[model samples]
Target: MSRESFDLDIRIDPERQRVAKQRAREGRRLMLLELGVAAALVLGFLASGASRRLKAALLGAGLASPWLLVGAYLGLVLVGYALAMAPLGWWSGYVRAHHYGLSTQTLRLWLADEAKSLALSLVFGIAAGEVIYWLLRTYPDTWWIWGSTFLAAASVLLGFVAPVLILPLFNTLTPLDDEELVARIRRLAERTGRRVAGVYTIDLSARTTAANAMFMGLGRTQRIALGDTLYSQYTPDEIETIVAHELGHQVHHDLYQGLALQTALLVGALYLAHLFLRWGVARFGFAGPGDVAALPLVALAVGLFSLVTMPLANAHSRWRERLADRFSLQATGNGAALARAMTRLANQNLSEIDPPRWAVWLLYSHPPLAERIALGSEAPA
Candidate 1:
């Protein structure tokens, strides 16, 4: 976080970079392992007497209401998944973060955030589950179409509310205080014809050391936010380089394009989930498409579907990222500043400068740091 610029190689330290890379690999493996554990539990419930007994217990309790049954069913799934993944979650989320020197949070604070997130997920999940089941029951013949439509709309609505309603839950966001830098950002916004609602700095340092800047929301909700981590560590131009890349996203209309792409993909993913769930119901003893017991079937099917489509998602993301980088270069005309900023970000975030090609194709959302830096030598067209 020194004011002076530092060489990326020296600052990151080769040994530490190696450790971070190894941690990255471990983190990915743990993710797959967690999914395996979840699938296993779902399979266990479906394949054993437990699923029927649990359903029977609910019936015996006079909670014969379908809505209540779906709620309770998903609550059980959430509890099971949390318990089963607890150790792996701790290792991957807390242990690995601390080991890599990324986390600045205490265990208690981290747990508090996790608990809040879990509570939010549970509330939203149960409500969404209830709706989906209702739709399936009401319109069994074309529930997939309804489900996809509802989900696509929900995703877009979530984006509109995320800045104000969702983001404040975890981090404090205050208007960026540096007058000079604020002026610079506003100037860029003005020139680009992108009206920003506000420029804010998020309390990113409270949890992690990684620095970042981004544009969020759409229309009235649209704004730019810089992590306090970025403010503390990076130069003004470097910060501009980052923010400009985000602005590029806005100027290029990537948000709307991305949303459209996402909606199309959601429709496809939901249809696939529907098909898989139907296959599952026939293959197993689940009651029907709307049956609460089939929540696991839906989850596992969706998980598999997402994994199968990830490479496509990642490739599209990388393409958008490259375009953004090129846009930033032209907008700011500060390739050197961008290279420096990217280097520092990579080191602080423990990003591999150039990850394995397979990982890039399968997982990376942004181009590698080296690839970005190489853009420094090209003339913006």
Candidate 2:
């Protein structure tokens, strides 16, 4: 046989090929199962008179006293957290990550991390709920509108605070001190007219194998954070590309835009929630707002709202991600490097190369790797 023909005969081991295909199938199956279960839960809530019961409970509790209403809400949140932790926290978050070779955390460490996150979430959730309740009382005629506005303001406040206050609870963050890499990144930031206050690195590898880089904070506190795994695994050029992409988010004001968009969405959702709560209470024979028995009603309403809005939110996020990818390519002038970085990150995370369209539409916050790479390559060098 000719040398050319022999070279073309490269083959994959049959067993390895089978395993690869099986893994792909399994990933798709799991994705579908997750979405399906979420949808079923949302539907069940709507059908089961859950919303009405919760509204009645909330109303009764609120009428009795503001403190009573707050207590009832906290109780509901604790119960929901307990239910979610068993499956999502214990089994899915811990067991599945370990089973898939993605996690390096011990069970004790994982539990500790989960507890911290739960506490933070509870605090934030309660604060936000109290604000919403106050707004509802203040503007009984337009509770939804006013409530949404309050929620949006709270969300932005949280965003600004998360990197500085909340994030440190789970992982150690240290200022990036590698002189050579810092010099290169600072140079890049200067060229893009972005100030480089400092670079930070997170010990994400302590928990999961996922590789990521992010631009956090706003104004003087604004900084970039790179996962340790990213620094260790990727080349300098690849890291530059990733950093540049993150910087793009800052340059384009994506963070602020995202906050605004989310606020608008939440306002709409609150208005819809108000409408639905009234109907739900009537249909489900709820006991009036503050009743503990009405917790399920509230859960079902919120769950359904979130589920229905997933596709829209995912699409918006994907658009921002694509824009960032393009900006990165332009900033770094290295499409191939960015592509390589993306592929490496995906492989490290065991991400599916071509997830089902519906799944991607519903769940993905970033464009698929292939599309990102293609856009990067097609951009002017």
TM-score, per-candidate, Cα-based: 0.93, 0.83
- The C-alpha stretches of model 2 lying farther than 4 A from their native spots are 1-64, 286-296, 376-381
lDDT of 2: 0.70
The collision pairs in model 1 are none
lDDT at 29, model 1: 86
Q: What would the per-residue lDDT of candidate 1 be over residues 42-63, giving only the tens digit for each residue?
A: 7787778577678778878887
Q: Which lDDT values do the candidates have, in the order given?
A: 0.80, 0.70
Candidate 2, residue 326: how far the Cα is off, in Å? 1.1
Instruction: Tell me the tens digit of each residue's lDDT in model 2 across 219-305.
Output: 666778999977777777788899888888888888888887788778666666666666655665654433334444555666667
Residue 272 displacement in candidate 2 (angstroms): 1.2
Best by lDDT: 1
